[model samples]
Target: YMQKVAVINSLEEDMKALPDEALAAKTSEFRGRLQKGESLDDILPEAFAVVREASRRVLNMRHYDVQLIGGMVLHVGAVAEMQTGEGKTLVATLPAYLNALEGKGVHVVTVNDYLAKRDCEWMGKLYQFLGVSVAVIQEGFSQKRKRAAFNADITYLTANSLGFTFLQDTSTVDRKDDLVRLAITRPFNYAIVDEADSLLIDDCRNPLIISDEPDTGATERFLLAHKVKTERVLRLGHYVIDRKLHRISLTRDGMLRGRPPNINDLWEAAVPMGPYIITALRARELHRRDVNYIVREGEVKIVNTSTGRIMPTSRWTDDLHQAIEAQEYPEVEIKGRTKVSSSITFQTLFKYYSKLSGMTGTAITEEEEFHEVYGLSVTAVPTHKPRRRIDHEPRVFLTENHMLRTLRLLLTKARSQLRPVLIGTASVADSEYAAANLRAWGIQHQMLNARPQYIRREAKIIAQAGVPGLITIATNMAGRGTDIILGGNPKGLAQLALENTVLPAMAAEGLHQQLVSSLPLAQKSWPKFAQLFPRLKAVVDAKLGAHDTSEGPDVKDAGGLLVLVLSMQESERVAKQLRGRAGRQGDPGETFTLVDLNDPLVEAAGLTSGMEAARPFLQSARRYSCLPELSSLTQDAVERTSGM
Candidate 1:
């Protein structure tokens, strides 16, 4: 890797001396060489050098030595476990550009639509400057647009979107348009899956399904079962719940107890009631609003547990969807009553790719699975600088109130130091809970979650999360694909200022001024808006031109962004991701985990017994100033015993 980096660096000066047009012509030159039977590896150094120079000229960014190593790993079809804040997004451009030289389509798979769009637009500048055609596939795109996008040299899309498109194409028997057929016929040559751990491991249990015809009389059965479970009183021993496996089953006595009172034929009705009753029980016990799913526009939307983003088009299988609907809004009509027509697991879907590579900060833990299942090796790329993040010992609290108290104190201290704070919660409800407490304490903060209102402003909120003395509460959505600079994101702030202040004022001066003047912000600033607009525009432009190095002296002096984990996630990788948010790219930062004894993970992992066993020791150690060591010991014990 070092030798390759040296070779690439040796050619950098020559590439830099080329004019913009000549730099871009290198793409055509590389393609010509490929057509003459030259292998990609033979021209790898020059290709990487060309990309690095193009990036520096177009995006004002250059790839580091480690990032070049990461690109090489991905080009050879392996997983690159690069740490957060190491510019993984920029690293991807290397292999993506090199592979696109062959004219075989390169697909960059993201975890969500927001990232797909963001990466496409942000990196499209560099790719286009190099004369490489880049496009993005998003929801609501027409077939013709999709065909054009798929035909481009490079495309950005979510893994779910790609899988569903493949499923739709496979199920299409009679095509009416050439565009649809062409789009469906495109080959999956090379795929780069971002957030590899979340897609390949955390979400591997659920398969992507396309539903077909609705089941007859299934809605009524679901409603009846939900009514019996909620309205009727039942004994505690009626049903059994396995939290580990997320399964629910009813005993013989529970079956008798769940039946309708007016049903006279016991044996005849009981046979049909078993499935519905069990499904309803599972929905009630396992599924939760604001956690597993959320109600939007009178529909139940499934939330990806790992990423904390709403899966708008995804639905629960079996009768689980109907049961949840019946449980949430019993009076409303139950929709999405359909059966599975075709399905494909992510493992099976990615196997169709001729070359598969991935990048994530937490793939080392799943190294064995990656090699055994996908035949991919995991390589950990060294960071450009030594990591300076300080990880404090985990703190355990016996009560939620005590935990909140400590959190309040920490926030106060962070505010005093003028440090930015990022609080990670386990779910939307937890985020709101933290927000409510922050409000009570009179602390100004931003909240990011799966809620519809927050989803649209996700990019804006995350962009300014690192501003001095600001606190941001987020779920798993902020864990991946986010870069929180130590000071602030100049470009994002400038964009927001333009959109909120400048654009509306400019639009208001036209014939539609009445419509624009009615807005609250525009109305308040309209008196001197014209005179102030120019100054605001100048500032916005100046900020936009400045690069984000995240080296604010005051911010660094305050110890960078402080990450507080309010609860332990199901996967330790997620907790690591949250911690990884701070100390990015060798920045100074600190992270501490405060776990409540009653946290869902605690109960789910069966750690309540262990906590009880160590409770006395923990309390005694707290008085002696040995709490940190004791807490670390307890945490290690739990991790070892639970196999997390």
Candidate 2:
């Protein structure tokens, strides 16, 4: 860790010493180096130094050597696990500075309208300082606005926003009518994903495509008509399941019912209850929702689940969205939508970068996944100060009911401890259940999950989470990019304390005594012993601007923030992300759950069967039984799922 600090400090000095001419010239040298088939590693230091200095001259902001090193890692295409508040935005300047010279343009992808605009205005300074023009894309921007932005040397845009625009751009009758349409020929340049994991991985499974079709009533009629007919058939199960093929076939007895002509004409391929039939029905019955997806006028508008913003321009292609809407609103028009063009998959999108690398606090365990999927390995960046987080493992249960009872008990225990606990739930339904149960038990907790607004308000809740006796019920994923400190939140003191040095006298101060003790030895070495340490003062005064502040007062006492997760999520990926929420950057944190037969993933994966066998013996300890130490079982499940 100290060596890393030394390297960072050295790089900062090197950047400060270089002259503009000498620094800007590094771009040419690196380009030449690349042309000669030299390794990026060979030119990384000089290349990074050049961009670092260039950003200073161009944007008046100099990169910390750590940022330069981060840029180097990105240039080599790896995941740099930089912590929050480490200037990840400025860090990209090194590489964006290098890649922009290729003249292909670079795509800086963000999560929402807010981030896109914010990053451009903020991070754009570095690019502009370095002689690169920056443009931002937001929803509802005119074609001219989009064109001007995309034409810039570096274009910042939201992942879905850009994708949807790409689709709309291509569908325009005249190419000259829009900017994205104009840039259609520019080829996708380097794309730097902000919150890379969400846009690139969590959303990878969905395709971004452009579709075109002549609107007709025939398609609309089919949707309404099918919904009416299938509604009855589904309950009856017109087909019997073969299970072996995971297929449902039309039963001999049910086939005898004469097929209705209207339904037959619209869906000749859809035999009710068969795989195709079920899929078409499921698409309508389960896919689209007014809350998550709204049908405005005649078109389907996909809601941004993470942000809760209305994606007005987002549409369902090839009739899927329309089909689902038809089931929900039988009276609405069900228009035919067709796919016109597409380029997707998280792997393919990130691969477009000539050089790709990023810092995320949560990438070590996913190093292999990153390598396998995006061909990027993970490199851990030590924190400036030793982490002092504390987390605990789940206490398991035999049944969902038992898990609930155990949770109530745990919640009671947590409230008694006065060590604010954050409970992560697997579903919206689960969140509601927990909320109701907690309320019944006289527990006061804040709920945050899939609601789009909740994510935007992440800092607010996390900021308040440290208040002793506060309980926050969050979605399993709500913990990302946010840290929980111990000894309850020192309301309004975080920004000042975290960044500035804490003084001995300040440490001895009454209200903050508990907080100062939570600091590591290195943290306690700062200059003053005044009323407030510089770090604490800095944290308190830090201008978080529009972005959420992570600065929290350090606290001492029993285990830090208590993290209580109800069930393990479906993907091991989620399980990893959950554990990651705690113990950030070597913080002393513990994470535990009450896992048993009640969790859906366990049942789906057959772990519940094993629990069933062990149920009787573990009755008295029902709700607190931890997941048994079954190595062979875990290994078998992992392999089986891998094969699947």
Candidate 3:
């Protein structure tokens, strides 16, 4: 690593000396070498140097030596565990450029469509400056647009899109012309997944499937099951539910009561009613309103458990989705399921890539999983500055209500100090409840969740979260990609302008006014910003106007941003991602995790503990029990499932 950095550093001085035209010409020259049979490794040093110079000139952000090391780690097909503010997005450019030279697309996979679009527009500027084409894959794009995006030198997309596209291609068996619309233009060449742990480990179990034509019989069965009222089923003792496991079984009496006429036939055939009962049970007991999903436009949308984003295209397999629609919007059509024409797990899909790498704020805990599944290892990239975020010991309570009360008090205290607080909740319901509590106290704050409406506004919400006395509540989706700037985000002025209109002149003038009056930036920071973004500057007498450099710091004296985590995620890595939002780029900040024993993670942990404690007793009983094999097998299964 040191040797590679040394070579890259040696070329930087020479590359910086080139004129703008000369620097721009270098991209073509590098392409020429690659076309002439030179490996990416052969041009690594100079190519990285060129990118470094380009970023400095274009974005005014210089790649640190550590970032260069991270870039190299990614280029070699490894996970670079860089911290929250280490500019992993910029580090991607090095490898992205090198790999894109091969003319087979390099995919920069993000956690969601919002990030995919944000990064493509943000980083596409840098790549476009270096003569590389970029495109984004998002929902609602036409087939032609998707093909165009996939054909780009570097395409930014969610892992779901990439997986679904692959599945779609598999369904196309007709002819060569038909394949054009279904296929992703490039082969599975090189991919750099953002939030690697969330995508590769936490969400790996679910397979991507393209359904065949809807089965009307299955739809009828779902409709019939939906007609059986929940209260009637419970009152009649027709179903037994295991709340913790989210499973339901039909009791003998209940089975007889609700059993279809062809119960015996269902035993041997693919029973639609069996799945209907399970799905109904799960929808009623396991999936809570707003907590697990939200009702929007009379449709049931699956909330991404890890990110707190609404996934409109995603649906439960079997009859689970229709079961949900049946329960939520009884008047709407109960969509029937198609046969799974094609399917692939993320584990299997990622394996098709010629080369794979990933970057995330946290990955060490799942290091073994990464290596075992993707043949990738994690490397902790050193931060540009020493971390100063104070992580307080977690506080535990007996119930969620008690925790909420304590959380309210903490928010009140943080508000008094004028420190912007970001509270990370586990679900949309939890975040909504937090918002409600804050509102009851008349606390002014912003709420972000997985609702479709909030997805587009996420970038701005997160960006300005660090301003004085701002209380922003969000789900895990806000944890990655977005950066929480200390005091204020100056760039947000430009973003706001662009969002308001597409006209460049209007945006530039509008951004100037917002920067001068609206931002909470320190007076000293303005001149530096004006110089960095000359196009957005409104000058007077060869100097920035007095209004441009007059704003005072809003919350710098309040100890910067404070992060509050309301509940624990299933993985410690995810918890770390939330805490990471507070202390960024060595900024002074603090974070605390308040836990309730009723939280899913806490409940799971307790269950694991109970299972472990009972293991020896089960073993002892097995020695004398007639069903020794079954007992031993149950013990082993418990150990494995509990990760003991």
Most lDDT-accurate candidate: 1
Candidate 3 residue 167 C-alpha distance from true site, Å: 2.6
User: Arrange candidates by lDDT, highest first: which order?
Assistant: 1, 3, 2
lDDT by residue for model 3 over 601-632, one digit each (tens)? Answer: 65555444544565556446634222233334
- Worst 10-residue lDDT window, candidate 2: 545-554
**The 10-residue segment with the lowest total lDDT in model 3:** 539-548
Counting clashing residue pairs in each candidate, in order, gives: 0, 48, 2
TM-score to true structure, per model: 0.92, 0.69, 0.83
Clashes of 1: 0
User: Candidate 1 on 1-644: residue-level lDDT in tens?
Assistant: 88999999999999999999999999999999999999999999999999999999989999999999999999999999999999988999999999999988999999988999989988999999999999999998876788789889999999888888887776664344444464646678999999998887777667889887766566777788888888765556998888778788777788778877676533476457767778888888888888898888888889887788998988888878888988987444587478778889899999999999999999999999999989999999999999999998788677687788889999999999989999999898889988999999999999999999999999899888888888999998989999998777877877677677656766767734664467557645755664766766576766655424433557888999999999877777888889999999999999999877787766655667766787777666645223444566557654653434
- The models' CA-based lDDT, in order, is 0.85, 0.59, 0.77
Off by over 4 Å in 3: 173-183, 227-229, 233-246, 256-274, 399-401, 493-556, 607-644
Residue 60 alpha-carbon offset, candidate 3, angstroms: 1.0
State the lDDT of candidate 2 residue by residue for 538-634, as single tens digits.
5544533211333222322434466677765545545555555555434445566665565544555666676677677777663345444553575
Q: Give residue 126's lDDT in candidate 1 (0 to 100).
A: 97
Model 3: colliding residue pairs:
238-254, 307-477
